[model samples]
Target chain A: MAPPSEEPTDGAVSPADYRTLCDLLRERTGLSFTEAKRYYVQRRLAERVEATRMPSVRDYLNLLRFQASGAEMQLLVNLMTVNETYFFREKYQLDCLVNGMLDEVVRHRRPGERVRLWSAGCATGEEPYSIAITLLERWPRVDEFQIELYASDIDSMALDRAREGVYGERSLQALPAELVERYFRPVAPGSWRIIDELRESVDFSLVNIVDPAQVRRFTGIDVVFCRNLLIYFDDLGRRNAAAMFHEALSPGGFVALGHSESMSRMSSLFVPRRFPDAILYQKPAEGAGA
Target chain B: MGLVKAGSKGTLGTAPTGAAAPEDWTALLEHADAGHRRHAAQALGDRPDAAATLAARLPREPDPAVREALLTALVRIGSPEAAAGLAPMLASEDAGLRNGALESLQQMPVDAVEPQMDALAGSDDSDLRIFAVLLAARLGPAERSARLHQALERDPHVNVGLTAAEAVAELGDPAALPALEAFAARFPDDPCVAYTVDAARRRFRGAS
Candidate 1:
């Protein structure tokens, strides 16, 4: 027996159908949409709806659910997502690294020890690449300690782009021309590819931080930069992600969240460390546990 | 030693084989390292059979992160058994555990938590009853207004009455006004009671 299709009244996505679709999107990806994005979502939704040759949005929903390859889902992710990913998105955090965190991180470290930094929700590698550039340009002790950088995003398409390491003018807006000249060479007129060495520095992977199977592997991290990502997570998801970061960090390791997001509000697992320049959260030393 | 691509996978410990047995994860719940224990609790959310074990560990678990994992796992299980496991933790003297249990209970369906609420409200401990009232308030007026109104009218503790009054104000249940007046007359000396009663009166009058 065939399922009857509920064609929307105006031959467009209905409010009920829009909510149902958005709920599915939120379930699969952490991204959410409010009524403000309805037009934008509807526009992209219309294209997919047309492209799939479904009679209506309801039928398209069935395709979205039963599609084994998840091809349509990827298209929706790429289209609906416009989260700003750019070099030096927040300069103060970089300043905190050079002036405060790195100095303190090295002071307690033995000679020639490896320092690991994990960047959760590093969308298309801009933030992690900027960190790499900061270490090379500003931190004089960059050569004294081994630095292992890992950046992860839940989006496979974004991870592919991150590995490619090419960016247009918008992604590099925060970067000074001199630094840009030093780090990247033009593959085209406006787009530039990160110099091979810098591109290879960050090992990018597809990771959803909430899933224990995916997140449990990260351990002994010295600093974690999970900026602007937890805002999408609900209470439980945020708590679990905080736990993952705490478990991953070495004793006394620091976590750098987005300027707007606070670790203290999300979980009591990490200790809040206030520096004159910036406040960061740290995994408490063994004697001190929150 | 400059920037090095240390590969994606960490070299710390061998990865556990595919789909660890529930018993394996349950044992890991007691692992000496809090991280492993935390991971174990999180992984056991997929195993309803381990809900009791997670609830049992909540009181004894020293690490906040691991205790959180236990609460989250129990919330995810969301069975009556899981709710039962969490209800006992509400009686804990440790504020963190009690609060954690409350927050987790709020995530459950009202039906799953209703039995636990009855038990907690009946507890001789004022703190436990307050916690139950807090859970009801968190669940909101639509789910447990009758219980809250009853608590306001009957519960002997001033704090419990205060919580119920606040719940009425916050939830804005006009039907709860008589209970609010009873509470107001019940505790005339406490200014907060009169203040809350006035607030609820204002909210109801405005709504009408």
Candidate 2:
């Protein structure tokens, strides 16, 4: 544990300090601060202040400025960003991703057609890699197709971990034994790292799901695995993101949402497709109108 | 020292004997440095006394690595005392600690945690609530089954509702069949809910 960089001369935290922290965070990560977030900011920053052995909040802010060049920034981002995930998380949705969606995309390919999958808000990279592994397992000639997986998260640190593709034993619990043996290598004492093949399959980048124009740039995606991530956003944000997915996807492309999330209330742009325990949506094919 | 040595794999005082009495386990703990603590703790291997000692030292350990070692030890030890030591850490300020503690508690035998299952079921924390549902499913008590049915109806978290539905299926209680049916009807597309409903129907039919 690092000591506080600087001790507060006054016991009270000032409003200016709070504002500065919020502004900095928003500028860097685009995470909006709610009225209730003041306490969360103070608590998280207090932990950092202690960890860095900084003398004061001002000094700590300065340290953050320099953190991009060091490990401190990475640690801070990792602590602040929420990586709520599990093995085979939202299993029903994954079933849809693996079952017919990939096959449909592959079948529709015109000579040099490429099947692309994007996992927006892919914390720690599990969702995208999970998709890749599923394709590799189910589709015999999957590698022959020009298959590309794009995984993105707003948090750079999370992207870093996703790129590294290492996970502990606990994360592997829900994964099947065969999948684990085939896709991962035992890296640390009790940790399993994703194989170089799987790691190379995914292209990790820092992307804010809320940005529409940026999303529109990645056109012709076959399937988008954006599961369990939209719950954090408000209704408007969710709708905008849904619309973005609607536009980014190729005709008849599929969208897999979190188990609890539905576009029923937000957008009728997608027609809901029912699987055994999962609900997904597909863009209407040619001659079909929403 | 004798207690620790008893728990450890290696023979005690093989090279040289010292003033360290077998009763002083602190020397054993001290010799068990950070890197080797996990292996040393594993040496305890399900002994109640060793688990209790490790539990006592876990809360105050400043090093996250050491705390993780102690947690792994407790999980392997798998005693009621180990569960008790880990319960409070479920609310640890550190996410890593909380994740570790919850995972350890999840691995404990459902029977050992049966007494506290109800409280966990009613917890505001979504993590604990889901864990309770899984535990109830494992234990299969009538009262827990009913509570889980109610949780399925009212739990805010969908995962909790899904887990509760699964627990009711495990209980195989006919009374829960209607609720499971309703849940399936409402979230007909949710595979987990469908699985639970199917399992409950099969179990209910078999029972009849």
Please identify model 1 stretches exceeding 4 Å from their true place: A1-82, B8-14, B30-36, B151-154, B168-182, B192-208
Worst 10 residues of 2 chain A by lDDT: A1-10
Q: How well does candidate 2 score on lDDT at residue A126?
A: 82
Assess each model's interface with DockQ, reporting 2 decimals per model.
Answer: 0.53, 0.01
Off by over 4 Å in 2: A1-39, A48-78, A140-144, B1-208
CAPRI class assigned to model 2:
incorrect
Give per-residue CA lDDT, model 2, range A19-111, as digits (tens): 676666544444546557667667787888888898777778778776667456556666776896756777666666667666666675654
Q: Alpha-carbon interface RMSD of model 2?
A: 27.4
